[model samples]
Target: MKLPDPPTEKSFPSPLHHPRTATMIGRWLGIAVVICFLTGLFSHFQQQTPSWLDIPTRPASLYRVTQGLHVLTGTVSVPLLLAKLWTVYPKLFAKLPWPPSRKALGTVLERLSILVLVAAMALELFIGFLNTLQWYPWPFPFKETHYALAWIIIGALLVHLAVKLPLITAHWRATPADRTPIATHPESLPPAITGLTRRGLFRTVVGAGTLVGIASIGQSVPAFGPIAVLAPRRPNVGPQGLPVNRTAKDAGVTAVDADWRFTVQGPQELSYSLEELRALPQSRSNLPIACVEGWSQGARWEGIRVRDLLELCGAPKGARLRVVSMEKGGFYATSELPPQFASDPLTLLALKLNGDDLDLDHGFPARIIAPNRPGVLQTKWVHRLEVLA
Candidate 1:
């Protein structure tokens, strides 16, 4: 008897499995991806600023806005990614080309790129959202893994765009073919009942993205604080009227005694008691403490100008500083303040926040508060400022 023919899979009909739909969703997703990538890059550099970069101290709220956008774009992308995946889910079941041809190899490679893109992006978004919540159950280091995966995702996305350029171009101005109401499908409820169409589906996807954004953005935008129920932090609800990322207790800090002193060692080593620091000419800055986790608050900070301290200690003009903190065993025990930041009049060893003495939880005694710097680099409970040329 002749060998039986192999079974063939039948195509499932759905109103969403159209190129027009995928293109529409993909465009929105692309915009989100670009925004997240650029803002994330800015945040990374703010944390690890290079010697050549002269990040400005003006506007003061620049870091706050960029970091906030980073988190917002990342969060909104979640819904867009899912909806894009669903629109093209049928493609996942497509069979590989047989008989080992060159065309088949190309097809396989394209599919492999898509796999990498999907996996990396999905994991990046998941880890990023978890990071905001201060939950880390993953074995890998969150920062390194997140950074590496970003490059991989971008690479895969570029490859995907190149491969689908023709399709994208064709659909860019093509009339909306799937304009038929979603109710026409046999399984779908009638338009009279569901009142949804392909256009409506697109609107619904955008709406989902907006809803998630609104619910979580209150962490960064104090105006929406009451509705930021889904956010991990309320910008105004924390120790000393600001959200605290790493507390003194968590940093293994014990109660500082009367012997505590703030020192600035340069060409001339100088030390001051808390009272002496208060006696020094104090300047005030309206600055925002912006964290990488997307929470920030504007505060009135009172402190001695970093420039004045440098001059008082007889440090060379435009000298860099190594800010050392009492907190133990972390990468941020000491942070380098570039010459520009060290000399900026706005840069301060803040002693008071919101007109009150610095709360230990908010970097008691003294803390570094420089413009356009990541909160992590704002060394808390500072005890020493070693002029590092």
Candidate 2:
């Protein structure tokens, strides 16, 4: 059996494959990429905070908003990307300049950059969306690969933009040509497929993007939960009416024994049994459990403040703290709380969630809940808090 011949530039005769259409869709896709990159950068730095940076400890839902936007922008980019590619894919078959001239070399380089951008972007989106689903079918480490690909995509995008600046500017606005259906060849004269005009393509792409956004955003917006068929998690669906990315069972954490106690190792060593912890002055914070995977919900959390605990333990002011958890076999089993977070009045060593003692899956004995922090860094099933200089 013989395979069919590959498609050429003329193989696709739709009037929609114009530079102006590519520009419009490409601009939207670019914006989405930029938004996704920035939000993902914030998330990355949250997990791996640099010494020079101090993540804020207010608005409590900052991570929730950013991560949600990260996922949202990434999701929206899918349709825009498809549209942009469809608009310009004919260029793939266009013959390059011959005789190995400087122009030919430049053309080759430009195409290579575009290839890198497309491949990396497609893989990045694939991995990123699946990450929200908590599924990793790929062998490569998801976080590292995803982070690295984001840089590659952005760099290639910049190169592409620089190379196509003139063309992009020329086609940035609607032109008279755009309003008229293009007839590049005789075969393309009679509408390749009925009603497949440029306007129709734009509407279809925009509609797809909107639909995906609506179906996926409910993971972060509880009001839209009913229509969130594409969402892997519902904002209000999990233990104590909140979602759980990592559970006690997965974390290798079990119910604590009667003798279990919470400890704070600082200038003054302190330990408290569960009842003793309950006896301490309690503060309530309406904070969100905002996961990096893009689901979040606000709930009342009651516990001792980290600053209060620091004071109780006679720790120095501005002391960084390490929260150690009973959770096993995970990178986030323990987390570091910087001084800003540790000293925040709303930061808590939470013992109760939503007015009830926490369930095991919700970090039963004790947990750390801080403002504007990634959910993974919230540190569940905490057993010890060690003060650092």
Candidate 3:
């Protein structure tokens, strides 16, 4: 049997490049980009400002998450941006009188602004991704470069939009969603399905899926991959050999039916209390708890890395990890580290702080101590570990 004929060029117009869709996407992306830029700037100021200015101590984990989101959105925007640019490319080369008339000058300025915006977007996304992967190629700090470029990009975008006001207005007037289909054939496409049509649905679905993939995989997946594979063993160094604060009665936080109880759970499984967790291989480290907040402290951390604990429990790889407090309402904070951190010697399910038994306020019983990361991501008072696949 023969397969159905492929869609004809005439039957399927180049695929609708809906002005409404483009505008909506661009507007939302523009807002997101602005937010990313502002947050980055604020984070920088928080670090640089003197104490007299009384800036709040920004948490290291907060910066990591915001920065992560910023980079993720920027990377995801790459394709959407390219598509928008292609859809508008025809206007770039449209015939114009060469004598520098007002219209010609205006068009020239708009195009130049677009060129700069595109270039800036490319540079920022590329550098941001590298930074996340722990690669810094340029002499300038990534934060500095990113901050400077952000202003330029935003300024150019504003100018470009202002100059294109007339065209944007015309497009809006021509294709209000209530009056017309949401998408139409690409100018390059054959004349079939002339007005906004079902093709728009396809683009929307594809674009939404792409956005989800970028957000989820870019931010969460890599960090949650199998811990054993990435961080096979604990790091030799820990919080600078800080003295343990615990009493002789609770060495290694092994005491049962006390202020602390270790909680370990595999993905989709019941959790174990502190005594149960002590049965696993034991490791200890003294490392620095560095914070992006401009404060650094050293402490000795003891316990198994969450990775080893999870592996012992037969937990699946790349699960969303959560740590809860043992207190009432289980008041807790969370940090999502890649599985690699789990196996790293520096990554500890710490039961002690400053060489003492776990402090109640400082995540007593058990907390996570991850090297080269902010304290907030450390998740203190760990009463539960929920593995989300």
Query: Which candidate gets the maximum TM-score versus the true structure?
Result: 2
Full candidate order by lDDT, most accurate first: 2, 1, 3
Which lDDT tens digits does candidate 3 get at residues 1-389? 99986443234333344455456456656766776677666555544544454332234244445544554465556665665665555455455559888988877777778889889977886776566545788888776787788889889888878976766666553343424443343443433344544345436645763654444442222333223121111212233322222222232223336544455566445556666666667678765554332223445677777777677667777544666644343112444555555555567787765557665545556778765454445665566776655
**Which residue pairs in candidate 1 collide?**
none
Name the weakest run of 10 consecutive residues (lDDT summed) in model 1: 5-14
Tens-place lDDT per residue, model 1, 1-389, is 99975433225466667778889999999999998899898888877777776788776788899999999999999999999998888788788899889999999999999999999999999999999998999999999999889999999999999999999888776464556665545776776576456787888999999999999999889999889977999989987789898899988787888988888889998999999999999999888889999988888899999999999989998899999999988988899998889999999999999999999999998999988888999899999999988
The TM-score measured for candidate 3 stands at 0.49
Best by lDDT: 2
Q: What is the TM-score of each candidate against the true structure?
A: 0.94, 0.95, 0.49
Model 2 regions more than 4 Å off:
1-5, 181-196
In angstroms, give how far residue 46 of model 3 lies from its true place. Answer: 2.8
Flag regions of model 1 displaced more than 4 Å.
Answer: 1-11, 174-178, 182-184, 187-195
Query: Tell me, what's the RMSD of every candidate?
Result: 2.9, 2.2, 16.8
